[model samples]
Target chain A: MNMKLETIETDVLVIGAGPAGSTAAKHAAMGGAEVLLVDKKSEIGTPKRCAEGVSKNGLEKLGIKPSHRWIAAEMDRVRLVSPSGIDVWLNQENVHLPETGYNLERKVFDKHMAMDAARAGSQIMVKTLAKELTLKDDYVLVKAESMGNHIEIKSKIVIGADGPESRVGRWAGLKSTSKPKNMESGVQFEMVGVELEDTRAVEFYFGSVAPGGYAWIFPKGDDIANVGLGIINSMTSKNAYHHLLDFVRECKATQKAVSVEFNVGGIPVGGPLNEFVTDNVMLVGDAAGQVNPLTGGGIISGMQAGLIAGEVAANAINEGNCSLENLKEYETRWVEENSLSFQKYLKAKEYLLSLSNEELDSIARAFQGSDFERIGPMELLGKLVKVSPKAMVKLGKIF
Target chain B: MIISEFCMYCGECAGVCPRNLIEVGENTLKFGQKPCKNCQICIQVCPVSALEVEG
Candidate 1:
């Protein structure tokens, strides 16, 4: 195999131009680092795999203005339906900033984020795939393919913000493999031309309908919605797409389905990877398993981690130290900020997954007549702890 | 080349393309034959079926 070696230099190199990668590039460039962001795809967010629901707090932290072209609708409430079809409605008062849900146009949102990184002076290379990572004397070498040519870029630090199936993390020598039981395969569909009254509310169906996972209905607008469902592979050997199709049929949403777009993906339900960094390399976003185990959301946590990783990388480079010890600061920042929430959510998911359909129905029924304030996370966790003291004890160890 | 049913109308392919060869419409995301430079990055990263080169 005859391959050409072309060497370029940068202060920081970020792999994958997704939410996390772009955010890292933006922050690194803002910190005055010569950052290069690369993605294998020609476009930034074309495939539309995410559910596109971000909490208001998450958006605020990123300082992003919710664009009219990007927002499908604002959600203020959530309904959790049990196995027996008993619905428990939680109003805005119960959830944190319920009135500020974002139904994002992921393609536009992701592209705009990359543009922000570019505006911050980060160079973005589209259609460039990072094939492998190699460590030389003191720099991390990024071997990539761009337009049938082999390109090599050297940087003092490399950040892996790739998705769940991240090769960059693995190439960087991090144990990034997710167990089958820890991963949930998900499928989502964008449905247009459907009339629904609760345009500002997102709905979730739990228990038997989703087994270890849940089904969601996030409204985009008056008649457009993103209907999706996730199921842990360990629960049943059924493909996520088939299960999602069955749920769609059961809900009778398929009857009026005019135009539907499908996305088949996976979520790492595990809390987080054991290690997020090594010498001169840090993994952020789904690549580091930074997703919320309960809601399967990663945009907020991913971006947050990206910011920390970027800062840590730049600092380490400036100090002439890129060892694992220096990179441990990124790990410390992430754990101090979001590890507790992730652990709590993971415990909640485990307990919820262990319940029988009848138990789930009972829990849903118990909350059916109750107000939203009565079903907060603390209250829900307290109830679960009461039921399963052993599980609660395990969660206590992490806290 | 024809756009597939998987297109989500994200308008991303057009934004990233150097040649401005792709256009997303109301119902469908389409690609024009404005000579795509045969850059297959769009095909590699397209989450849905918005763009593809003719066989």
Candidate 2:
């Protein structure tokens, strides 16, 4: 009887405070809807669990202005090192498109993003954990605990941006049905003192060293970098952390680097989930598994989807119908813009994992001789067709 | 019943294991000695073909 309980109401309740959640919260509030964003952590983005690489164009796609403060390194080229260490440097010069992006210090980036949401008229709460969800007349009720007190929040709509381990989506019956193959087990180390040959080119080493995955050296600065790898295929029994350590030991370029910080996390290596929205709810970011299958990068796609989700959720609130019928627009629109590319990445992943070490070396050779550029999944198919029309034909049918 | 090199350690199998018998070890996955009831849930959840079904 002595326990205190508090209650509040808002038009939208956004969960999680990563880039996706904060972006959604900002957009929803910008649309004149009362928004509340919550994160269980005391801080928004600490204990980073990412490789921290985002494409330059991807930021533009999400409409996020490049902030110099959090942008630790600006990549100029990406080198794909083959099994034989044949480096295929991909840049605007050869790839016909810019693949360069920033290596972010996510801790600072996420805090400022959520603060922006606050400035846009949304209330933000940290260290608040949503415990349960109940659907009631015209709204959803969220039961949460914060600072040793129980709180009840009512909202017309809920957006789950709660990362890979999102409970809100599960509470809304959108349980993750992803298979292990559709997820990437990733580990990274923030290292310094590596004599990086190309400070501007992020290096990806591919071979038996990282079976079923590729190890990367994303330079954070001239002598410091984030070295990580994601694995879902191959024949290794070692965990990804040990695999990364082993990779560092073996790579001539990474040997001298000393680890200063370590991070581990899982990535949804699948396309968007089968169901992203149901009655009165939508999911964004890793919660909806909106990451590239091949690259294991979600920040770009997650932020992009957040923009659409926030707009759709806000529109539904304005339209006086927060039902699944109205909210399903988020799903349709996101899929329209992103689904094909996601599916193609999945296909490309299958093709990449199927190739042997010798084939990878050959791929390096093929890229060297090619004049074609902009090697997205579709472009990858065109390149594959030149050598293996049969494989391309099979992949074409699926994609 | 061994985890091969292909695992990225997503730990989906551990999460889905009904008996909660899976443990994450350094660089590898370990299963408990409890006799599996043949639910096949772990097999169903594994994304890659890393699980060995038999000797």
Candidate 3:
């Protein structure tokens, strides 16, 4: 298996074989373009840096079915705990929302996605770390180290599906750097033997326990869960790990939990970038900050961005015009679908970060006896204003 | 910048570096040749307190 590595040429080269890169490679290959997908890890998915929660509707929209193989648990309810220990429960019966989702086994799920791309005829490479990129007139030359062997890939288009710590975006001259206020330092522990109040429920804790963010318990099984928390460290000097340790010590859901694995990451909660495409290069997924600012979820949105970018890249290549102008269609389509909502989420998150523990408790108290089915967004905001008028001044910008 | 032994090589600091002066491999963290202007955004975003300014 030790063959001399040489220069490879393709129509599209996708870096990082996560959901975004694999999906992009599949779509681009389906469009009749030669595609190459690579990841730095020896295995596609291990040491997952996520809470592993996804909505059923999101999967359905992408034509993906929740298979038993990759689904760890089916979620039915959400429990939000306030600063003063008030519990607010939301389910489909009460909230009139779908409320059905899955906690995935990301390792299996990611490998399956890479297999899909391979079935679509895209070349797959593991242990391939992209080191640098040189932009030429017609193609970008990517210098990568594959399996301890130096190699170069020349492609008409390059899709950067790297995570938040993307190097490709910087190589392409994109403004992808995040400010301290816009980033959430996240840490999680996959623990077994946890005593969960509801095996099918996802739990969240707010206020001083997780300043400027929230602590979460995403159940993987009846007795196993990923207990985690994220924080905007600019708001608090405490790092995410210390905050999570405090949560594990005090939160009832994780009190009996015994840790098996630990993972840490940074989430770009600043919304999508202003420009994700340059001449012959495009950035998708966290590389472009294509994450929901409010909830800090990126998988679904990253896949969506990947699909759009892949299709556009293929079309541009087929037409023999891989310029920035030809690739702007991906940006336009993504903006049409997410820009407005993400902007609103960013604004709401900013406003929420300014709230105090007392304000959060008061807000949670307002929902204690409210009828979730009857309460709309405006109605809920009106109630929050009534209880905490001082904190509702910027309500207009959020909604 | 000094990366302590507490670093798990999670790459949080690499993402926020304005000068793109950090590189994260599977288990290794490397600083680029470019000079750091002490933005300290990287230090603030570390999930673990692994990075600190050099004394």
lDDT of 3 by residue, A1-399 (tens): 867769999999999988888989999998989999999888897768889888888778777777898999988888878888887888856653222478999999989989988999999999898888999989999999889889999999999998988789889898998777778899999999899889999888888888878888899987999999989897787899999998899977777779999989888888888999999999998889998887788888888888989899889989999999999999999999888878877777777777888888888888885668788778778887897785467666564
TM-score of 2: 0.84
Q: What is the TM-score of chain B in candidate 3?
A: 0.89
- Give DockQ: model 3: 0.77
lDDT of all the models against the reference? Answer: 0.75, 0.77, 0.86
Candidate 1 lDDT, A273-327, residue by residue in tens: 8898988789999888898998888888998888888788778867888889998
- Number of the top-ranking candidate, with TM-score as the measure: 3
Question: Candidate 1: which stretches are off by over 4 Å?
Answer: A1-4, A97-100, A195-197, A252-254, A374-399, B1-55
Measured with C-alpha atoms, the lDDT of residue A334 in candidate 1 is 91
Query: What is the CAPRI rating of model 3's predicted complex?
Result: medium
Top lDDT model: 3
Tens digits of lDDT, candidate 3, B1-55: 8889889777889888888888887777888887888878888789999988888
> How much is A369 displaced in model 2, in angstroms?
6.3
* Descending-TM-score candidate ranking: 3, 2, 1
Listed for each candidate, the true contacts retained, as a fraction, are: 0.00, 0.03, 0.73
C-alpha lDDT (0 to 100) for residue A129 of candidate 1: 68
Show the lowest summed lDDT stretch of 10 residues, model 2 chain A: A91-100
- Candidate 2 positional error at A345, Å: 1.4
Tell me how each candidate scores on DockQ against the true complex: 0.03, 0.09, 0.77
